[model samples]
Target chain A: MDTAQFNEALAHIRRFETMLVEDGALILKFWLHLSKKEQYKRLKKLEKNPHTRRSVSKRDWRHAKLYDQFVKTAEQAIRQTDSGEAPWLLVEATDWRYRDLTVARTVLESLAKHLSLESAQSEITTQSKPLTPTGTLPSTLTILDTVDLSQCLRAQEYSQALETYQGQLHRLAWAAYEQKCSTIIVFEGWDAGGKGGAIRRMTQAMDARLYRVISTAAPTDEERVHHYLWRFWRHIPRAGRVTIYDRSWYGRVLVERVEGFAKEKEWQRAYLEINDFEEQFAKHGNVVIKFWIHVSQDEQLRRFQEREKIPYKKHKITDEDWRNREKWDVADLLVKKMAQLPEQTKN
Target chain B: MDTAQFNEALAHIRRFETMLVEDGALILKFWLHLSKKEQYKRLKKLEKNPHTRRSVSKRDWRHAKLYDQFVKTAEQAIRQTDSGEAPWLLVEATDWRYRDLTVARTVLESLAKHLSLESAQSEITTQSKPLTPTGTLPSTLTILDTVDLSQCLRAQEYSQALETYQGQLHRLAWAAYEQKCSTIIVFEGWDAGGKGGAIRRMTQAMDARLYRVISTAAPTDEERVHHYLWRFWRHIPRAGRVTIYDRSWYGRVLVERVEGFAKEKEWQRAYLEINDFEEQFAKHGNVVIKFWIHVSQDEQLRRFQEREKIPYKKHKITDEDWRNREKWDVADLLVKKMAQLPEQTKN
Candidate 1:
């Protein structure tokens, strides 16, 4: 058989499930089990019978010889893929009648359960109040509204403070490295919120070798294929190093949530997931610093106009920035909700 | 001082080496040490003088209490950053004059050595034969060229064999998960060599949740800012999962080497780096499988044309594929060299 045709056939089998179930997909799997003695007995019978002789090939005997390897491999696969939505049923195949009966019964049970679920869902849709998108948090006051965005620094004062902090950060970076401690600095802000300037100031003070500034952009095709958090996990700094995110996983709740890019349930669950992710960093004794750079709407507008006038900075101002600005109120509310979550879950 | 100005001051103090030295960078560091009693006496003197009083802030007094922490952090930094090219010199600062003299003498000595080495390099260039690229391996026959591309599978046989192998692979994947063993499969082949087909066949048989197929492309901005291999290191599968690389870190030698994307020296040293990386995976008990799918030039051309005729597959055949084909011989030779490196370095 040509490899291409074989691969095509394999593709056909795979189309049953192109991706893992993000929600639930009904899938039934059965594993037939036979003792070595029983397998050997069956093999001999197949070889003797003309109708089944073709099925008992030299490869079959070779596989039987490596039965232990097969068993171990099967056990691992079953364990990894076993979940509430999709499960494997191990059947004793020594007796064909028993194996068939057990498989048939299991399939019927699953079908009945699935039918009941479908009917129940329909009944609920007709009988209950329309369901809101899953994962919406209650509206409440948040730290965001309390921030004093009107606060401004004089040029001389800004310069002096920048130098002081940069110096401290440099020394602290070296200290952290010496102690084999890693650091993750997250910057979340509005458009033209001076994230770029602040990150530049920080990087300028540290040894380029000890820190990396990860400018988060749209997810790549490979990243888009995996869990949302997988991309962030891939970039965690090693011991004693620093990774500064220009924007970060908060996008799942911020941009992704406000823009409706992520389902309500996905963003809702993200609070717990993000908290868990941060806890792992804390457990590893990494310094985790998060900064929310805030700016007033008028100041943001001024910066946008200034960026447009400066040829070099024009690219930084985009249609998306304007679009995001329009939904600032929604983003503000969501961010406030997110901020409260960490404090609640901190213990 | 405002925070900005403080940060600017901090940046000024951080003019020391900011990043790790990828190549040798001339650097000199001095660790000035003073006895605790001497430090206390100096602090008292500074406090008495109004001019020096401004330099000694409340933070300085706070830091004095954690002198041990400072010492430990400094020691660690020195240890980690110490290399033959950029060594740290410890100087006793009990007397300011002695510390200054020691540092000055060390700097002079290092400068003299560097000058002499620079002259020696010029002389060598004039007197000796041209230097070969560093880390060039000896030419040797490898498994790559020995593959018989003409060996083909019939359609019926291919279908049957694929089913058998996919079944085995499916089972093995599960077993690996149960045993908490991760797997890494690397695919490197000629354009249109059916790598995608083979990978699909393997993935089809296993659960999507158990494995990830990473299609390597040009590095992202974040990836570009770090070491070339850092991106690959970020994606290593956790225990009980499988990661398949469509193209991998081997690109340093293959594409980067052939296309001049990497310097001659950088690609040359990658063989050892790659060996070390694989050894780490092996030590972690990962099942590593590498495939070099062989196909004749005629077959490759045929497939390329076939892809062009199919609307969905047309995008797969790009101008780059045609260009890459022009350098097939170079890639083949480089690959052969790379294949032999693992065997030599296994010990």
Candidate 2:
């Protein structure tokens, strides 16, 4: 109800409208305005008629009394939300015929304009070009290079540290439960970067009652019908619980972007949508943590081979995985773009 | 909420769970139990640790005091909502290891069962068989037969009646807008039955600001990804607004049923789903009206030929319309089923 909340809502609605328009929706909003005097005249005339009198409720009278204030507030909202993509039309409503005709004409014109450009609109060139790892990019010194591969933990030390950390995590999960703070953990990684092992360790530390691990694979037939984020939203954690996503919404910008599964506009707009979504978590006092695990190409190859050699793990290595291995430039773009997202938008 | 509202919510949730399971989803619900003494002890211990003390809030102590009440409420909820499709598993949670292991084991078993039956599930026989006009159903005395085609309006009288009715409807629309009552009009009809013509007349009568005419056609790529109902739900009328649908969700049971676009189970399940959806409209105090226009086969053929002869109306008659003419039994089943639906369900 406050100005800040109202303004933010207006911004959110405008963002949605712009996104729809960019995606080729023909949006035309109209506000049929009645003059305060004309509105009063119509109300009184309806009140005089027994059959129509019941229609004019107390709320209508109250609205009529505050018509000027209502108009002012509406004007403010309209001004803030107005956009070239989905422009608002203000029509005078003294004559019902004129108002109806005007609105219908506008609708017809918008539809016709949309239909005429249908073929041409399909030829819009995507702005995103594939990242070429050679020449335009450095041969070395990537964000992945910052991970010191030589770092290792001895078995005895690893066991001790793991127990201590796990114990702490178990206690923290309970404490968070007590405070009604739900948590979301998003995992993104190279195909063979040991995400499953890391997730298993994390889940092992927490009481199963307190967390749900959702392994994001391909979209199911049901999920395919909704927006990509719909499936993720459907499984949001309840209060005092945790949801861990193995491969999260960042797929739009990472794999989908590189693999051409998502068009440039879709993946690009997803950056803002994701930020807005995370903002909801913040607003609700929930905890969100994300991770990106990187493995060198040689290390990935080693793990892929190790998986193939194992009887139970053979299914983990697919032809798609082998195909994805050729896209090193994807990792470069993903790392850089992901690192910059928080800086570029309000989260 | 009142007891009635609470009970209705529980029933709604159980219904949703049943639908999901029927659609081949494997669902699991769990309740992790802890004694009041154990909960108090844990809270006390956490509060004593500086690292974890910050996580224990006043709400935790309040909840501890209401532990018995919470347990009773939980029991009632569990009793009402539990079903074989998604049964709740209660785990004794004094031991974290046992609780976590129990949950993980249950999940594994459910997944294993689901995966094992993947191939066998696809062989499910659809219950619905196409109706033949020849023998099975009565060849005459259909619901459509009740309509007297001999009834006709004089041109002069028709024009006067149209103006009078249109004017009354226009006034009523504004009245509904003033009273904040939304109206949803659903039209289901055979091709060349004047659904478009009727919708156009209705919209012409109402203020364009107060009504939107949604001409339901084949699902767009975006819509095809969602449930068949998704497109219908997307254009729901706002408060005081009227949404006139030229074709409607009844297509699931009508065209999709006879045409086999939706399997028997899908269409059969839609009967209940559609009722529940309309129940929401009633709950919101919105107005809903439905219409089915039928034209005799000979009359339909005459109109088809007449339409084809006119250049402007040529697009109105398509090959699909000519093809659908072969399925008179669709109209028969549609009339009987649609007529029986309200009586069969708690609509």
Candidate 3:
């Protein structure tokens, strides 16, 4: 943990971030600091036991050798790179009483930031953008409307329909894989707007051999080091396979942008950057599907409250939701911007 | 390479695979190897240039001290963990030319193996077992029967329909991202069976913000490690995002199983394993969509012949296609197996 190496790592991080943005990705970082005393205690325990000792790397011991330098370097990195588009949340990990609470709150806040951006961007696309004649459909119309939901398949209509679609998609996906086709799907909506239900319904019908579901939340340590998009890029489906996102990269515009965690330029440019990315995807022959579930804000409140009341769903709610509820107007403005973009404008 | 350590890695991989089976995830692993001679060449190159000098590690300079030990360990790891469910592909890299060709063939063959298994399993579910109702629609219906091709949302009629769906899905995918939902979609069909057409249609309508397409062809040096399924798993969609596979995981039954690249048991159990995996996906609320474009064998032949006559499509007529054509009965048997499985069994 020589201060020089620490500073150099920070520089490396900055350069890495620039490259990520150039490549159409963003990053959010965090630093969890356990006090020197606490680290020493943990080190002592490990030293006392050979079993635990094996897991401790020589690198760890070296890091411990210069704890102060490590801390100072981490602090410098945080200070230098933390910004609206990519912010760093520092956690004091000494007191157990405070650590969990602080970490959870910060994570909740970050998630809120990301989710709000999603909400805002969705609102913009669905609400502000006027329908175009080239290929764009009216915003009010639902893809479901095209389906003959009323034409009823059977007693097990949902299951049967799900199976039919999943089976065909599975096979088609494999064929695409043979041809090197990559797939990405997006889902968004008001709270508890059946996004999860819809995902389960669709996934339940396919062969798991060809697909996988990834849930995104707060960034982990390794994730923090890379750009936000880096983590997501890491999840890109190989050619001919499916990669689904419950929530995705739009967080810059919807959550981070609206919540002031990201500057206007950051989220504003994301619309174009995202379009460029999709252009690449299309060029590669990826089958890209994006869905937004619509529900009244009142429905969201009901679900939010319900989540608070349910033990299992309790994990779903956070104080930040309450805070976000208060900033609907700000969020709405961002949504309008998202909606104003052309359907397929290349960044 | 050290045979013991090689076996240890192999053992670790097998353990990981078993764990994934019970956990409903596929464990894919990779081993990257280059011979000592090649390594020396690289080191020599690096040492010869001022800029490339740092590429040589102290470890390389002291190879005499470690090479024998390392090789022995690596070999041992490889042998110990090779299993029926997950086996290792030994890439002989003494000759770069041979290695490249071998690796490419191995990848294509490996993919075929897994896909054929999926196909066979589906066939068993659809044919061997009772196609009894577990509540979903029958697994044999064509996409044309279900989707309203006649009631077209014409270019001018609610022209924004595609964009709307894509946008909505985009938001939904991001929401899933926040929630960390995993999603997968697969497409399978004969060549010219509208797999590419359908995928293009889907992509044309999607918001680029939330989706990506991955095209699978021959594997490069990087992907050969890990199990065949590892690369696919790496792309699992984060919650709310979707991945579409033009051709997907069914290669086991359709290609590998038919071609004799995989052992009987490997492809046989993929059905149950696949089902278990899908069930886990459903439990986790990720969506999976599978598509199989059905075309008569005559249709396939006509298309294959057409590829030979056309300059652009000529590349599509591979010797393997002709080889697979010779084993139509075996291929059909595997396809039947794939058709037999119920969505409930897998999803």
Candidate 4:
């Protein structure tokens, strides 16, 4: 390589090793020295041996001739790239016993030190609870209380409005396909909220082949073994497609927090983790949309009772739903807290 | 937010969801709709409720007044971002039962389809082995046979040379520290090669605080649970330092291949895996150096015998090392094979 290329290569190499070391790797470098006369004497002996004569190729002879230049270059490399993290050792190879013993002693000492460090690190386990958004909620007060439940559309107006919007959505979906733009939509809301209904209306307008709907439930055996987001990550749509999530990663800070599935630290970290997860899509030019549907406790209760009376809907209302219903106020508090960004809810 | 800010927010949200979907998340989006008159009626009712009266803020009334513009803007957002992967669903909230039932059924059907697809994916298990560089070495012909053992350095010459190199290394290491440069060096050599001796010589020259030596051994339980490189990544040196690896990642292709520790598929992947590991270091401006020490079988055996005669060195001569020595010819073939690039080694 030329001077520039050589320097570039060295920089690249230094970067590679630094990354490894920073990640907790220890590196060792060693070079054994042999003088020109010593090397020539060794090669001549190899040529004299009938068994090894064939091994003394033209390249070996050429390399031998370039020994002085090679030594200079190697020395330059050692000087330029050597760092405190990865030091190079030059061994005088004239004495076999000394060379081997020195290397062995270094290896033993380093191993002992590394192990000691590892043990010390393991002893340090920080048990401090992460600081999260702090605010006490009155049982009757929540953001959901602000939504006017009386809002409704007449049948005639509803059909007309739905038709108009659906048609527009269908055209837009195709446009996105042509542009190769992907979209993701997340729906998180009350158990009995109209989340599913809203999703159906949108999907009905688009081509059936154009979109996919994901309904997140309890973790499966496989999902339980991995991260909470692992199951969700398995269904990401290809470009120019749609993937709708009935529920999302928000559970970590919501239901999981309420139910004690995620510890204080894990859920506290979720805010940043969730943001990071979303940031990836933004970087990739993909579209994301999230919606929260709210329903009053009375409405939820009414829906739960109606479901129990209906055969098809009965299957949807589980004992778990009833159990979760009792904690509605707590869930409401979590919802409000999760909605605010870290800065917005510092206290 | 203003028009441009609103658009930017929408774009950001879209990208976030898109990323989640791409990672296998199924996203669902839903919006509940209410007419202006209905919204006003609901807010008025809430204002009369003693428990919820305090929740009706000025913002709520202001939002009610912006209903028309809000609807228009929501429509704009839906149209601009609607894609195949993540579709939007709008539900008419007039009838509670209708809204709840539609959403529940859509969720049920979508989940069924998603589960079926997941099962189908799991059924596909491709077991094809990766193609690696291929060549055969005759037992009589090996790379180790080429090293001439006759080369030796005089005691005076060795001492002078060692001092010069050590002094340069000490200076270079501190310079590296000042520059915040990092380096990783890997040593792979024959059982009784001067790898240790070479490493000791270099470490002695550098400040004790400047460099670290990592001796790679059998994988720990933690490492076994992760990628093969996990053990090494755990010891990455900080900036302005050195890390030396005795018996580095190359063991995947060298001893692991010969010893049957790694399967064919795993060893096959190591070439790419190792390159990727180094590339990370290079990208981060860290230096990486790998050294291979070669020794004739006669010299190695002579050293092994000498070590057995010495009290401290005797501990180093284990059955594993002796067994390994018996496979010198095979090891030679592997060393040569590994040294060649894929293109050079390809049959």
Between prediction 1 and prediction 3, which has the larger TM-score?
A: 1
For candidate 2, lDDT tens digit of each residue in A138-248?
Answer: 345545557787778899999999999999999889888889999999988889898899999989999888999999887876677667887899889999899999999
For every candidate structure, what is the RMSD over all alpha carbons to the true structure, in angstroms?
16.5, 7.1, 28.8, 22.1
- When summed lDDT is taken over every stretch of 10 residues in candidate 1 chain B, the lowest stretch is B15-24
Error of 4 at B9 (Å): 53
Clashes of 2: 2
What TM-score does each prediction get for chain A alone? 0.64, 0.76, 0.53, 0.62
Residue A145 miss distance in model 1 (angstroms):
15
CA error at residue B182 for candidate 1, angstroms: 1.5
lDDT per residue as tens, model 3, B1-347: 36564554455456557756543343334565776777777778878975446446687789735767778866766667666566677776767798778777777777777778777866664322211123123335433335442353568655577667766664555456557776677888665566877777677655564566666654443455445565566776656667777666577556765555545566666666566555556656677778877666677788888989999888868887776566654555556557766658343
Most accurate candidate by lDDT: 2
- Estimate, for each residue in A1-347, the C-alpha lDDT of model 3 and write its tens digit: 68676676566556556656444344656677787889989888876874345445688889998998777666677898876666787777777778779877777887787778766865664323311222122334334335342343566887777778877765565566567777788886555667888888767755576677777665665565655566678888876678888877776667665545554445556676677666557645577787766655676789899999999999888998777766655554444556566777233
For model 3, the local distance difference test gives: 0.65
Q: lDDT of model 4 at residue A31?
A: 86
Q: How far is B6's C-alpha from truth in model 1 (Å)?
A: 44
User: What residue runs in model 2 are displaced by over 4 Å at the alpha carbon?
Assistant: A1-142, A154-187, A195-257, A260-290, A309-315, A329-347, B1-140, B154-186, B196-253, B260-290, B305-317, B329-347
- How well is each residue in B267-345 modelled by candidate 4, as lDDT tens digits? 6767766766676575567788878888778889999999999998988889999988877766777787677634311
Deviation from native of the Cα of residue A107 in model 2, angstroms:
4.9
Off by more than 4 A, model 4: A1-143, A342-347, B1-347
- True interface contacts retained by model 2: 0.00
Q: State the weakest 10-residue window (summed lDDT) of model 3 chain A.
A: A128-137
